[model samples]
Target: MEAGLTERSDEKGEEEYVLLDLDAVMEHVSIRPDTPYVLTGLDTLNPMLIIDGKVKLIGEYEETIGTCLVFSENEAPVLHKETGPSDANLFSGRCIVDPNQVPSKEVKPVARLQKVLKFRLLLDGVDDAQQDHPSTEGNASNQSTATQN
Candidate 1:
């Protein structure tokens, strides 16, 4: 996935800021529940993620390195283990970027920004629905049996 830039309203909805492409990031990286990762080379001032075209601030960073946590869509109920008590959070395979990466210089317009993010896979109770279902032969046999009955 490729990254793109967009403008978004600030915290107080008073100013507009740049939004980072998060869907692209997720597509490029693997996201698992309860995993920590380091996303480098992000725009510190406008360090936000874009989901469904909506802008969301990941967190404040110092030097472009932020510790992030990826959570599965199915783990919403037990998300407290990864994040604190914050019901108002963005879902859809959550990636929580820690406020650490501090920029060396002040915020400025970057010609190009490339980031390398590391992610892990957490297949604890994951199951493939297609694999669990019966095969074509089994389905045909079952249909025949049902018709006979």
Candidate 2:
């Protein structure tokens, strides 16, 4: 608690002092919690690896012309194959929850979002062209679109 050093006692009764910039510690992020945010540093090609967990979230499904769209965490739609007749749970029905079954206490996330990330768009050399610019016949930039065909 003194200055910038945070002190904490370990299970072994040993004192550990860690240095941290407290101002950069963010409890609230700019993004929405209900919305699903994709953040993986690894391969996204096997999208099922990244997408499979979404089917467990609370959402509804819609049947389109060819495919059925199932929604994810934030009501984000995910395309799925239509459930045909012979399927066991095809017409089982919607899931219903009783009001008394809902938990009373709200669970706050235990994960600490220590680092605050900020990004700026730095576009270099974006100049506007003059209106009604004149072009010369011999100008290299004035190439004809006519092809050999």
Candidate 3:
């Protein structure tokens, strides 16, 4: 995962923004015959909100989240057809494999092989409107009384 923020100056003042990027790879290879697998159910958690500096909310608001998933290989083919000259051509470096390897009978079918690439961008100037509102005088005291259930 990677995160960074950008800052720019306008006639009013300086503004800051944040961006997050994440990449992941998941794979499973089957060693048993006549067993096939399927991949399903991809999900993500909502983004948590963090506030800094002296800012006060005069009203409540909701934010919508977005996500994306990318795959390199979405399906599994027959073992014999899994590799070929085209595969060798696609390799960027040397390829090595054991010639006398034996398949394990206990191996189960692979159900999922996936690659996920994601990014989250916080919209610009979200707090600008709030800056116009008057700060809550007792916000600090109220925050201290909220219990952590």
Candidate 4:
């Protein structure tokens, strides 16, 4: 892949992956304060492997669902002096982000099929015979089958 500053890098070879400046990436992804974004496709030997930054979450790409991108990775090791409940505390309030990961240079991700999460929606009383749903013309395949009771 060409360098990050190239104007047509996204259109060139390895089109699915394009190097972009931090500002350009931020423009495409609107991030709110303190919200953690699970970035997928980082395991594809991208140059970002050795970049200096704090990583809240990272994963390998699994598949796309609804408008969301899915990913999977093993649980990260707990950071030193974790803020969560003590082992003595059985009931937990909420999980905190206090995990440690080896430096990217030291860790080379292996390409393999992860024991990924499979999800499904269970809706009762859904029948196709009485179906009449409103759907937009464009991007019909992306839309879900609307159910009526």
- What is the clash count of model 1? 7
Candidate 3 per-residue C-alpha lDDT over 4-108 given as tens digits, one digit per residue, 9 for 90 to 100: 212346899854221221211012221232222221111222232212332211221222143222112223322232245564475534454445655322222
After TM-score superposition, the amount by which residue 107's alpha carbon in candidate 1 deviates from its true location, in angstroms, is 38
Off by over 4 Å in 1: 1-21, 38-44, 48-149
Distance from true location, Cα of 116 in model 1, Å: 20
Question: On residues 17-119, what C-alpha lDDT tens digit does candidate 2 reach at each position?
Answer: 1111112212322322243422222121111101122311111122223321111122223333434546676434444334545334322221122222222
Over the stretch 1-149, how does candidate 1's per-residue lDDT look in tens digits? 01222323476763322222234446545434333333222433222222222222243322223322211122122122244446675553465434464323222221222232222232345432223322211110111000000
- TM for every model, in the order presented, reads 0.16, 0.16, 0.15, 0.17
Total residue pair clashes for candidate 2 = 0
What local distance difference test score does each model get? 0.29, 0.24, 0.26, 0.29
Candidate 4: tens digits of C-alpha lDDT, residues 59-124: 223333223222223435443443575888644665444445552222222222222222122134
Q: What is the lDDT of candidate 3?
A: 0.26
Deviation from native of the Cα of residue 8 in model 3, angstroms: 47
Give me the overall lDDT of model 1.
0.29
**How would you order the candidates by TM-score, starting with the best?**
4, 1, 2, 3
